[model samples]
Target: MSETTLDTRTVPHDMDAEMAALGGMLLTPSAAADVAELLNAADFYRPAHQTIYRAAAALMDRGDPVDAISVNAELDKLGEINRVGGAPYLHTLAASIPTAANAAYYARIVADKALLRRLVETGTRVAQIGYTGEGEAAALVEDAQAEMMAITSGAEPEEDAFFRSFMPQVVAGIEDRANADTNLVGLPTGLNDLDELTRGFRPGQLITVGARPSLGKSTLALDMVRAASVNAEDPAPAAFFSLEMGRNELGERLLSAQARVAFTRIQAGTVDDADWARMAEAMPRINAAPVAVRDDVNDLRIIRSVCRRMKATTGLRLVVVDYLQLVETGERSENRQQDVSAVSGALKAMAKELGVTVIALSQLNRGPESRDDKKPRMSELRESGSIEQDSDMVILLHRDDFYDQESVRAGEADLFVVKHRNGPTATLTAAFQGHYARFMDMARG
Candidate 1:
C-alpha cells in the first residue's frame, strides 16, 4: 500500500481517539498482564527498570515532579535506570506510565489511562490500533500487543518456564544473590573453613542439622545463623522460625551465645563482671544485625504464611527451623513417620520454591543411641523418608562427649556430612560451648 493510503488506513482518522482506545484496551487487569508479557519477551530491559518505574510512581503518587530527563537522571543516580539505546524510549517511559508490578501503573490524574482501559477491552481492536499498518508508533503498539498476548497466554513469569526460558539468566542470578543477601543477616561464627565449604548457608538448600539433644544441633544452627548474618562478605537477611522456643527464649540464647556466658548462667542471672563485660562487647553487634525470629506459627500453613510474609518484608534468604519435630505438620495421617516425611519434604520444596536456604534443626532417632559411635548418618536423620530425599546437604551434629566425656573436655564435636548431594561427604569439627550456645572452630580436630 502507498504511504498515504497506509497512513490513512493505519492511523485512525482521529489520532487522539485511536490513542485513547489503545490505552483503554491495554490497562485491564488481564489485558495489562498480556501487555507486560509481550514487552518482556520482545525486548529486554535491565531488571532495574522495574525498580525505576516503581520509584517514579511513588514520586508521582506523592505529587513530585519528575520530568523525563530528571527521572532518568534520578534512576541513574540510584542505579535503577541505566544506559538506554538511541533516544526517547527512556523519556517516553517516564512520560507514559507508572508501574506496580507487571502492568503499566498510571496515575489516576492521567485521564487517558482510565480511557486506555476501555480501548484494551478487546484483542481485535488493540491489534488494529497497535499494528499501525507500518513506524515508531507501530513498534510501540506491537509491544503493547505482545504484552497483552503474554498475559492472555496465562503464563506466570516466576513459574519455571518464564524464569528459565524467557527471563535472562542474569535475572536468576540477581534473584539468587538477593535471596542470599536476605538469608545471611545473622553474625558469622568465625569458622572460615565452614563458611567456605557452604557459602554461608546458601539460598534454596534444606540443610538438616540433626543429632541427639545434647549434641549441639540448636547451638550449631544458631551459631551459623548468627555468624552468617553478621560475618558474610555479603550478608543475607535471615528469619529464625523457632517452633520449639519462644522469641524471648531464643533471644536470650543468642545473647548468651554472643556474650560467651553459659546459657544456664544467663538464665540463672548470676552474671559476674567479666560475663557482663563480654556481653557488653558482643550485644551491640548481635543486636544490630538484620536477624528476625518467628515462633508464633505452628501449623504448616501458618508456617508457610509466616515465611511468605517474612520474604515479603525482609527479602528472606535463609530460614532456620529450630528442631523439625517441633513443627506440627498437621497432615493427620495414621503414621507419624509419614507426617514427618510430608513436613520435611515441604521444607525442602519451600527452599527451592522460595529460593531460600532452610537450615532445619532435627532430632535424631534412637538410631544414634543404638550406634556405638553415636555420630549421626543420613539414615539417622529422623523421618528419613522426605528429609533424606529433599535435603541438598545433611550435617549431623555429634559430640563425642554426648557419647563420652573425653570428646567434650577435648573441645571436639563432629559435624558429619552424611549427604552432600552437590559436594563431598566428610566430617569436620567445631568446639561446642553449650553454656553460651556458641561453636568455635576445632582448628585441629
Candidate 2:
C-alpha cells in the first residue's frame, strides 16, 4: 500500500462480526457464555456496541435472559438507552445473525480485529518514542519491548478447560513421575535433603532465602544456580541478578565455590598451586554452563526485562536475585516497607509471567539476635510486609557457628522452611563450608 493509503486506512474493526456476535448472544442466551469468553466491552470498536455487550453480560451475570427487550431495559436502567440508539438498535442486533451457534466464531473475529487495532496503536506509540528520543536509548528499547510483550501476552486466548479436560495431562504427569527413578521434580537445589523435602523448585514459584549477615544466603543461592546449570546432567540456562555484589566478586565466589578453594585465599590473592589446578579443572564446566549474570542493574523493571529476554533467547529456567533489599522499584514509596513490598510482589509476578523459578535472597531483621535462640523466623524478614505472603517457599538460613564458634553444629547450617505453600514445613541441615564459600549435602560432605 502507498504511504497515503496506509495513513488514511481506518483502524482495524469488523462491524459485521461485532453485530453478528451480539445478535447471536441475544438470540441464544446460552451463546452469551461463549461470546463472553472471547470478547469484552473494550474489544468493541463502537461505543454503542460496547454498551450493548455490557448490558447483555450484566444480564447473563445476574441469571436474567439476554434478549432484545431485556437488554433494552438494561440500557434504560443504566440511562444509556439513547446512547445505544434506543430499542431499535437492540432489535437490529437480535436479527443480524442467522444462527447463534456461530457466536464464538464471530467473537473470535471481533477479538482478532481488536488485537490488530492494538498492534497498530502500539506501533504508533513505538514510532513516537523513537521520534521523541526522550529517554536513554536502552531504556526506550526496554519500554518498547515491554509494550510489545504486553500486547502479545494479552492477545493469548485463555483456555477455560473443565476438570475432565485437565485429567489427561494430570494423569500423564503422574505416570511420568511414577516411571522416573527419583521423585524429585522441578529444578534441584543440589541439597539432597532439601530436594527430598521440597521436591525441586518449580516454575512460577518465588523462593525466598533469608538470613542475617554472614550466614551464606548468597552462597546457597549460587549453589542452586551451579547445580541447576553447571552441574546438572542436562544443563539448563539460568540468570543471576546481583544487586549487592559486583561481577568480579560474584565470579570469584562462584569459582571458589565450584573449585572448593578457600574464599578468603582467593579474596586475599593468596591462591596456591592446588587451588589454581582445581580452578583450571572447573573452568571448562563453568564455561559450558549457560548462566547469565547482571550486577549493574538494580531496578526491578530492568531485572524483569532481562529475565524476559533471557527466557526468550536461552529458555531460561531459573532466576536469582542477590539480597532483595537493594532492589529498587523505580518509584520509591514514603514507607520503606511499601517499597520492599512492591519489589517482592513484582518479583513474584515476573516469576509467574516468565515461567521461571525465582530465588530471591532476603535479609532478616535484628529480632533473631534479640532472642536467645538466634534462628531467624519468617516474621523477622526485614521489611516483612509481603515477602512472606508472596513467596511460595521461605527458607531461613541459620548457622550455629555464626553465633557461637564453639557450637556443636559448627560447620553445619539449618535451613528453616518456615513457609511452604505446597508442602509441610521443616528444618533441613546441610554442610556450610565457609572456606569454600558454598553449601553441600551433609552426606556428600
Candidate 3:
C-alpha cells in the first residue's frame, strides 16, 4: 500500500464554527481570553483560521486590540498575509458572527470537531502501526490510549495565570464544601478512625500500603477494596489489579472475609454446615458490590487500560494494585531500582489522570527486619524510595506477632501513616483475623 496522506482521509471539522469563533473574538476582543481557554489555534480546521486564532490569542495575551485590522496587522507582522488570503479573510471572519454573545458555544463546537479529528488521526496511526507490525503491540496500544486521553482531557502545557483568576474557583470550592452536609471531604475508606484522620482517600492520590511477607498487606488491601466498594446500595466502583495472586484465590478470600469464615477452610474445601450458612448469607453482599479483580495483570499499560474502560462504563473511583514490584514497566531500565521508581511515578500520574484513588501494595526491604523495633518505616519501602516521594500517603503495615509468636498484640495490626500530604499522620490499629483474612476496627470498651 502507498503511504497515506491527510488530504485523502475524511476528517470531522466545522469551518462555520471556526469562522464564527474568530468572528466573535474580533467583534468582542474581551471574550478572546475566555475563548482561548476552550479552543487552541490548532482547533481551527482551516489553516487561515488557525493563523487568525493564533494572532487573536497573541493580541489577547498582550492586552492589545483584537479587531480584524489588528489581527491582520499581526498576521502581516508574522509574514503570513498572503498565505491566509491577506486582510480579506480577517474581514470575512469579523462579518460572520452576528454577536459575540455565543462565543463560548462556537468555541465548543470547534473543540468538539478538533477532538474528532484527533481521534481519526490517532486511530489511523495506530492502525498503520498494527499493519506494519512495528514496535511492541502492547506499547503501541498504550501509546494510542495515552494520545486518546490527552485529546479527551484537553491536556496542555501549563501557562502562568494571575492569582485573581483562580481565587474564584478556590472560594467556590470552599463554599460548596461548607454547604455540604457530610463531614467527609473525600471518598470514604470505610474505616471510621482512618476516615476521621484523613477524611478518606481523595482523588489524584497515590496511596502506598507497604509491609513484609505474611503481614496481611494483601488482606488489608482487599479489606479496603471491600470497604470502599461493598455494602452500599450504589457504591463507588473499584478495580483490583493483582500480580501476585489469582482471581479465583482473591475471590475466595473475598468470600471468606465477607462471611467471616476461615480462609484456610475455604481453600481446603472443608467448610462445615455453619460456615456454609454464613457463606450463603454473604453471597448477596458480594453479588451487589461493584468491583473488578484482575489477577493476571502485570503490565502498567494493561492496568491503565482496565481503569480507563471501567471509568467509562462503571464510573470507577478507586484502583488497588496488589503489589508494585510485580508491575512491568514495559521498558528496559538500567536497574531494578530505576524501573521501580519509574513505575511509581507513572502510577502517581495515572491516579491524577484517571481522577481516582490508587492504593498500591509495596514490599519493604530487609532494613525493617534488621532493626530492633521490627516496624516498617518510609525508608524500608523496598526497591525505591520514589514510592514514598510519589505517594500522597504512605501506610506501613506492622503486625508484631507476625515476628514474635508470644506478643500481646497478636491479633492486631498497625497501619502507620508515615506520610500524609494533606492530613494527620498516625498509626491506626485494627483487629486482624488471619484465618478469615479480614481486618476490622478494634472495639473500645
Candidate 4:
C-alpha cells in the first residue's frame, strides 16, 4: 500500500454505524455503490472502507445477483488490495453478523475511521426521503424549510431553542460574495504584483510556471510556496511534488535563498565567518515554517490521497507539482502525448474538485531559442502545448544573463505574463541574485 502510487479513484470505507450494519450485504449492489461514492468525497476519510465498499459496488454493478460470492469476486478484481484482511474476510463478516441485532459490532469494526462512518450516515440520511408535493406532504416540506432557515439565519435563540437563529440578510450577503468570485482559492502570498495578476491563485485554478532548463522556474515556485506558507491572511498549507532535486539539494537552495548567502559557499561550507553565521541564523527561521515535504510519490492517486490527508490535518490551501512532465497519468498507453494530456486535464479537474490551487512547473518549448528576442511566449510550453489553453495563468521566466551580459549589467530579469485569461499581459523585473539563488523586487535592488 505504501510502495506504489496512490489510487485516487480507490473507494474509502468511512461508513457510519447505521450503514456499517449492512457491511457488504446491506440492500445489495446499489447500497455498496452509493457507499463507495460517498467515501470518495474530498472531505472523506477511511479510504480502506471506501475501497472495500467500491469493490462490492463494482461487483454488484455488473448486473449479477447481489450475494457474498459476487462481492468476494469483485474484491479480487481490485488488486494490490491490502488492508490486513481481504474480501473473504468481508464475506465472513457479512455471513457472521446480522444487521438488525449487530449494529453495535458493525460500528465497532470501523470506529477508528470517522469519515467512513459519516459517509454511511450521509446515505442513511438521504435514503427513502423523497419529496412530496401536496397537502400533508407540502406542510412537512414547509416545516423542514422553515427549520432549515431558522438554523441558518443566525438569529438569537428564543425560549425552547438553545441555539442562535440564522438571518436571511447575512446568508444573502455571503451568497453575493460567492457569486461575485467563483474562483476563491487557497490564500494570498502577499506579493502585490503576482497577487494582482491572478487574485492569488484561487481554488480550482491550475497555474503553470514554465521556463527553459535552469531559468529558475522551481525557484519562482518556491518563493510563492514559502510566502504562502508564512502568510497571515488565510495562509495556504502547501505540498510539493519534486520529481527532481533531493532533500539536501533543495534544502541548500532554500537556505541560500533565505539567508542571502552564495549557494556554492553554503554547499561547500567555505564561506567567510560572517556568511557562516548568517547561515546558522537562517536555519531556525526556515525550519520553523510548516511546509511539509514528500520526497517519494509518483502516482496521481497517492498524490491526491496524501493531499487530501494533508488538507485534513493542516487545512491545505495549495498544491505544487515540481514538474508536470514527470507525473504518470495512470494510463498504460503507448501514445505518450495522450497520456500526458489526460494527466493535464485530470490535474485541472482535481484543482476544481478539491478547491485547492494547483501550481505545476512546465518545460518551455524549444522554439524560443531560435527566436530573435529569446523571450518566451505561450507557445514555449513544450510537449503538451494545451497547457496554455488549460491554465488560468501562465508565468514565463527569463534571465537575460543566460545569453546577453549587457542585460544583466543593467540589473534585470523579466517575468513575462504570457497568458492571463482574466487580465492583461504585464512584465515585472526582479533582481536576479544568482549567487544567492534568490529573486527580489527590482525596487529593493
lDDT of each: 0.62, 0.88, 0.84, 0.65
Model 3: lDDT of residue 120: 85
TM-score of each: 0.60, 0.66, 0.66, 0.61
Give the Å error, residue 256, model 1.
Answer: 2.0
Model 2: residue 21 alpha-carbon error in angstroms: 30
Instruction: Put down candidate 2 lDDT per residue, 55-132, tens digits, no spaces.
Output: 988886566777899999999999999998999888898788889988888999999999999899999989878878
How do the residues 9-43 of candidate 3 rate in per-residue lDDT, one tens digit apiece? 56899888888888888887445644675688888
Error of 4 at 170 (Å): 12
After superposition, the stretches of candidate 3 with alpha carbons farther than 4 Å from their true spots are 1-169
Give the Å shift of residue 4 in candidate 3.
29
Quote the lDDT for 7 in model 1. Answer: 26
Q: Could you arrange the candidates by lDDT from highest to lowest?
A: 2, 3, 4, 1
lDDT by residue (359-438, candidate 1, tens digit) is 88888888777768765667767765688888888888777776676653556777777887766777777777776778
Model 2 whole-model lDDT (C-alpha atoms)? 0.88
Give candidate 2's root-mean-square deviation (CA, Å): 17.7
After superposing candidate 4 on the true structure, give the runs of residues whose Cα lies further than 4 Å from its correct spot: 1-186, 231-235, 408-411
TM-score, candidate number 3:
0.66
